[model samples]
Target: MRSGFDCASFRVRCLHADRGGRLSAVERQVERLPEELVNKIQAGEVVERPASVVKELVENALDAGARSVHVDIEGGGAGLVRVRDDGRGMSRADTELALERHATSKLRTLDDLQAIATHGFRGEALPSIAAVSELVLRTREGETEAGTEIAVSHGRRLHLRDVGHPRGTTVEVRDLFGAVPARRKFLRAASTEAGHVAEAVTLLSLARPQTGFFLRSGGRRLIEAPPADGLAARLFQLFGDRLLEDLVPVEGGADWAAVRGFVSRPDRPRPSRPSLRLFVNRRPVRDRALAKAVSQAFRAVGGGDRGFEAFLFVEVPPHVVDVNVHPAKTEVRFADGRTVWAAVERAVRQALGEGVRELPRVEVAAGRGEATGVAGRAAAAVGTFLDRGSGEASGSEIEWGGAAGPPDRVAEAEGAAPGVEAPVPVILGQHRLTYIVASDGDELVLVDQHTAHERVRFERLLDRAGRHAVRSQGLITPLVLELPPELRPVLADHGETLRELGFDVEGFGGGSTRLSAVPAILGQKDPGPALERILRDLADREEAGWAVAGTRDRLAATLACHSAVRAGQALNRESMSAIVRDLLQTAHPTLCPHGRPTVVRVPREEVSRWFGRTGWRRS
Candidate 1:
């Protein structure tokens, strides 16, 4: 059967007959939707959640030249949300038009879109918000005698009237997404949603230091930041003096594009990259290229493996950067992204150069605590052994028990065949208590004591874990750690994996965890720092979509790093010899698990060339 539908009246009718003389149904596949339906569709994109609503409203306030903004929320902003700002308010006519789609004073024409100086220019915030919630907007321009109040529900005007109000704007929203039950059902728990709202406000607060921001949830103040003198003061106000002292100032760039802000010192690394905040032209954003630039700069200074906390600001002409790329405006497209990346990298490198302290030098003393020449100082610094019979200084060679025995059982477990022997380097004196000086007949070898042991321990630990033989050391009293809400989910997801690696952890209500035991390999070392590092590594790997085997390897590597000997700790001859022997027995003798060189070999010919004896024969 064939039938036709009237587009105007949406009524079904039999229109024509088919080839078989039977009527068929025919309907218009495409038609322009009504304005109300259009607004509801736009709301799907502009208002993702309560946090999205908060972001749009706050951004509008900032664009209005507001010096102070306050936000209050209830039921994670799904029940009610109120934002008040002290700034230039709109008049009665403008206030009424503000609720209309595509009605904005910030954008005059297409050319204005290319150079957007304001936080909002699309003018879809008010209308989109009003489409899904009950909203009340009140405003009073400075010259006006009375303010205008408008009430709207689900994109329909309910009432409008004149009222007395301050010379600013206040917007109250209630029953967010009430008309759209599907969207409301997707919202998380109140606490989780509130955390997202807080994060959104925090980013905006950091972006604008001269403006004061206050946030309250369930009638309790969450964030209260007053106007700050500068970025440093703002950082101190938000994160306190400890973070302020850990950061180094960065300032440099060309006139076309400039960069400035603060980067964390090498020693103060955070577990994740969220601690690094980025802003362009006073707008907070998340850009992978800019973040990669910062990471590359920190990697040069021996950091960035774990993340670093930084607050970087980039200033470029509006025409060169497009902030309209994302509807939420959290992403940007640069005209010349490489140039901006280089500018950021160079500025951070310069700052690190000035902020990082010089490496410590080992001081040497002469005979009986008396000062000596360079040779005596060098010998003493390397801990030269004295001859027992004559009481005279021996050569650099340190006496070991004997040549290394057969391959270690850990190596055998790691795929090494039985009865296999690995060549061991002759143990020489230490170098600055960091490197282990050794000789392999034709080459002078230098081993990083820390990484050497790290490799050895890593292999052993992996072997034990594979065999389910990991040893645990129980604590006399359980240790309690208060974790952030974000980390609690990570802990819950990976709690089993943690226990498999010799960590006995259990949740103790209120976003805290109880630690009952740790890997015995940690020994007397404080397990707090190591446990935290492991948890962070697990979280990062899980987010990166690592396989189960890869996650296990990462956990073992983290445990090995904590149990290994420190760089500055003094090691005796036996300790050094054992590390060298075990390091060679491992499958990979040249590099550590983290890809750092465990041993560096300088050929005899290279040393001879340095001494200008490459081709000399007793001449």
Candidate 2:
């Protein structure tokens, strides 16, 4: 305390200070990142994996107006990837600038960004690839005497020279992620990576049907397609003639928007929904709204098993579509998603409506022959949906929903001759009180009771509405509730559609709505959430120019789902029979409106083999 500068005073004097005040202990330092590091970071966004590399290169090839594109790969593209294209190539100056960041010929100003037609407008693809791998670009302009070659590695230009070459472009990428060991370590095995590369090639080839595409992996050709006349021809070239059998053509449009594609018949099903490929403006995109529209169309056609196969191409005005939403350009934003959805759904439905009458019926017949298996006694024990009469089968048609009856008597009710034509499956016993097992001639059909009933009610409700407006039941007491601000626009937009679906909802002062009536089909269901769901759906895409007519069907589906019978509940044998009869009368009897298979037919011979009954000759 006696010195001129004490310890406390010295400590206070040693503290650092900004012009305004003393610096904090944990202040962060900031500076411009190195160019190499910046490029690497940006590359991470564009080039996610080997398949990403393939996507960018192919898109560039397309943007260059390539008529034929060849993709060659090795070691799942981790070893080598090459794309050769016969297109309008670039000159020496363009080749040099292409490796530079943000240098693109596709865009000039703000107007181009708003209406981007070309695929690789971002110009980040080549530079991004250059940053991660050893890249060599050899390009020759159409009228140039010679070509320009540029070699780059890890974002550094190694060499540039002139060479004699054809009027085209070839880009080769090797040692991908060699400089970045962390990214390389994440690469999958060669085969797995190769599958992704093949898929990417397939998608691009499908998008550009008129362009020839050839893809090879490990020197083995994976896909090859010649130029196609149209989308249908391309599908045939890609998927083969077998796919054509299951597909139905769908085409529809509004003033400036249109949708055209093929949807598989409800009967021909796959294990999953991957087969549903949707393209927007000639570019393949995985969009939820478009996919949902296709699915809804399938459900309307009664697809209640596995999902369906569909290829829908939606064409909208370039200005109305935004392709800049994602770096990959696979995802897009539409100005009026609801209009597009409505157009697609209507197209699919119209196609199905026209072809439903021509659809072939499912049939499994046992060839007429002596009981060579030597187990004729077991035939009667094993029930079938088809009752083959000796001369004429009796007890085939059962009076379902009347009263409990003997199984033999029920079979006799649906009497028919055991001939080429199979009778309706005789309702057998209910299994687990859920499935209705029925026997036709040589097959056993298992019917999901709940989903089947739901389909029935759904189709019936739709038919009722199509003929006349859905009836509304007035609520005893009007339910008043608060509405979200987003839902307000929905009310304004789809008020007529909601009323068409049997909902009477109106604004009840500030941010609240009063629900006075509900769809009579809903019965005792709470209309609150149903109405809210409709509103939320409507609000999700407000600018969709057209009033969403599908809103009625969606609500109808909800009502049907709620009203459908539950499993584990006991249903009389006659009631089960009635359900089956009603189901068969509907448009798509095999599946429910939700695309779940309501009925599955197991062949009699296959069942026999399961029980160790063999020695039967092939039919």
lDDT of each: 0.68, 0.65
Residue-level lDDT tens digits of model 2 in 234-275: 777655565677788988966677988888765442323335
In model 1, which regions exceed 4 Å deviation?
Answer: 1-44, 272-274, 357-619
Which window of 10 residues has the lowest lDDT sum in candidate 1? 1-10
Q: What shift in Å separates residue 581 of candidate 1 from its native position after superposition?
A: 26
* Per-candidate TM-score against the hidden true structure: 0.57, 0.54
TM-score of 1: 0.57
Model 1, global lDDT: 0.68
Off-target runs (Cα >4 Å) in candidate 2 are 1-44, 358-619
Best by TM-score: 1
Tens digits of lDDT, candidate 1, 29-111: 11233445334322225777888889888998898889999999998789988999988888766776677655577766566
